[model samples]
Target chain A: MLEISGLVSGYGRISILHGIDLRVEKGELVALVGVNGAGKTTLMKTIAGLIRPTAGRIAFEGSEIAGEGAERAVAAGIALVPEGRMVFPRMTVWENLMLGGVHPRARPYREATLERIFDLFPRLAERRDQKAATMSGGEQQMLVIGRGLMAQPKLLILDEPSLGLSPLLVQETYGALRKLNADGLTILLAEQNVKLSLAVSNRGYVIENGKIVLTGASSDLARDPATRKAYLGRL
Target chain B: MSAEVLLQATVQGLQMGAIYALIALSMTLIFSVGGLLNFAHGDFMALAMYGALALYQSFALDAYAAAPLLFFGFFLLGFLMFRRLVQPVLAAGVLAGAQLTLGLVFVQENFLLMVFGGDYLSVPTVLSNKNLVIPPLTMPWPLLVGSLLAVVLAAILYVVLMRTDFGRQVRAITQNSDAAALMGIRIDRVQAIAFGIGIGLLGLTGAIIVAQFTLTPAMGLDFTLIALIVMVIGGLGSFAGSMIAGAIIGVSESLGSLLYGGTVGAMIPYAILVLVLLFRPHGLMGEH
Candidate 1:
């Protein structure tokens, strides 16, 4: 479970996120949909502890986490699959995944988590010894998501998981997210693909210029006139 | 020149090159992880040398025996330096970190001067005056033993880098610090340890070379320049490239000195560096 209120953060004197509030319950897949530069990443990063909030409160499972560094957030069981598929280019896929489980909490479950990840993405198992840089873009995306799962985090946050991915690959990725959610994983996904993101999410928030403009059940939001027109391109 | 002469020069060059390669490896580790082009790397080596000398003088400990102690000590010193100095400037950029290290060069050099008084000092081990003779080729006992030790140490480093969890985290950070952080790695802690190891390696070099070369406070710049040249020639972050480039430089210098003269020999490594820069700027094993 996670909660945030009045979150404001930015890069050195240039504020991107204004006062904002958001929440996600356990075992729910929540989607934050916004256009490019709508502070989707800024919010995700703030929650994951990559960027310290200028002003706000972030509580994860009843504990304050705001302004804590990334490592602390990770130890508290928040794993973020960052925007760009940032895999260690020179390392093998196995090495990349192993690094995911480096946290003290995750180390014990490393073997089991690794096996589950391989089951989810068998392509990775096939290329376990291959360098990450040599993989295709879709495979790299899968690798990053698998890497995030390797942490065995209580809350998994993904920023722009669909960026630069093909439509079919995006569908595959979302399908995997659907299964993971059904299996009781708590996920927070930020994406620009409104239709696809809303399709799989239990509840969704529409972010505009760093503020949450709409929040509701996925079905209702998808059918709303404003949401359909602005995001789905059909009214 | 006779074949025997050529064989002797090549063998001698390789022995010395092995030590240079070890020095270059230490430099590469720091640059790859911390993104700091430490100008004080060689000064740290000078410090290690003095440390070895002091241990020898005080306790009658052999240079070889003092190596592990020096490594552990320098590792702590480097760790503290990173925490107090390097980490603060790191956010500013690589140049800021480099400038900090440049300032460190002055501090270390002056400190050594004040203590050691700028004398070219050497330690005489039992092996220092001995030679290994076999048929047409004769090797100095110190050079043979030092090279073998250097190779063994390098192999140990390679194994650690490839097999350890810390090594995995290090490689990950080297490739992408942001992603490494997302994995819950303490970047500051890892970098600090890495910096310590980088400087700590100078302790190994100091011990190995104490008998082979003389020590002076001002000697750091020459080694700094050599390490820089080796890094460039080997490709900035390539471990294997450093070893090979070090060998090339060493062989060229040795052969040049034998064939042409001391001055011409000293210029050979620079000439090779220029050619490598012109032909393959990324280095032999470096990839973009």
Candidate 2:
């Protein structure tokens, strides 16, 4: 349950996100697909409060959270697994997960969260003391996902989870995300993996530059000829 | 070299190094988490020493006796200093923070000169002129006590950082401030507490200075420079490394004093730092 209206954000004088509007209903797996430099990351970052919006009304579960810092967003039940697995490289695997649980609300349930995460990603459990930088790409992805879950967030916004991942790893990661959605966790999936994102997500939005160009049911968009040609590389 | 002479220099060097370690640790603490070089740090040290002077004048209390009061005073001073000086410029970037601190140092030095005058004042603690004799080696009690306290402080600092949840949060901030804040840490509050502690540690050093040595209002810059050199030698973000480097510096300074003269020996840390930076610019254990 989130609503964004006419959001504008950017770095310095260079405006990367034009006025954009989007929303997500409860327990919905919504996909936002865009090509490189298409403002996908910018939009996600704006909602998550990494970058302050010059103009926006971000309502999370009916509370206005526009221009709030990232910590406030996390406290308000929104977690962003930023692009490129931005895990603390020098921190130990266990430490990274512990960081996710640093909020007071999450502190009491940290052990339980750790147990669930360990169960979900057994590889991380095996290398608890190992530094995150040493982990393989797939493992690091799992670690970040696990880290986001540690916050017990109501809405998890992931930017390009499949980037730099092998096809099998992507499928596996998608399956895990699908399972998360099925378990009633609302997710915002941002990626260039149109087929995978649209397949797993119930609804999708296609973006170009800083504008939303298309929006509809994922299934219908998948069958759409123009989207197929433009995004899926089909003639 | 005779064992007695060698032992004497080593002992004095270690003591001097320990004092540097105290100053260096505070610098590293603020630098790592707060992301400012804190040019005003030595001014804080000067205030502590001045505080002792005030206490001595008003209450006729010994420096050691006034230590607890100085510690809390400096803590409050540090906490408020961060709120006024650091918090405002924090968002503007590290350069702003650096300049703000440097400005604060100028203000403090001028204020001290106005109050205390330009004269150099010597502090004589209870341990002053006291000596511990052991066979061929007889050491002054002031240096011995200062070094002992430095080691103890270092150990305590290590434990607090390595063994507690608060320490974990500090390390988190050191590594990633944004991530740390997102984890529900009140960054401002934590930074304030850390700044307070960093300054509070200077109380001990101040006491040692007042009781064992001498000071002038203009001498704060030297401490700041010494602390920076120690941090650079130890590595910017490494606590243990700083402590070790401080001791090494103290011993080297002693060696310089023996080889050259006192004035030339004082120049050793800078000359040595230049040499070290020429090769290992990141420092002996710098993360960079």
Q: In candidate 1 chain B, where is summed lDDT lowest over 10 consecutive residues?
A: B118-127
> By TM-score, how accurate is candidate 2?
0.93
Find the candidate with the highest lDDT and give its number: 1
Q: Any residue pairs clashing in model 2, and if so which?
A: none
Error of 2 at A215 (Å): 2.1
- Per DockQ, the best of the predicted structures is 1
Cα lDDT tens digits for candidate 2, B78-128:
889788878888779999999998898999899989998889886667888
Ten contiguous residues minimizing lDDT sum, candidate 2 chain A: A226-235
- lDDT, candidate 1, A54-97, per-residue tens: 99899999999998989889999999998989999999999999
Q: How accurate is candidate 1 locally (lDDT)?
A: 0.89
lDDT of 1 by residue, B1-112 (tens): 7999999999999988888888888888888888899888899998988898888889998888888999999999889988998888987999999899899899999999
Candidate 2 residue runs with Cα over 4 Å from true position: A12-14, B90-93
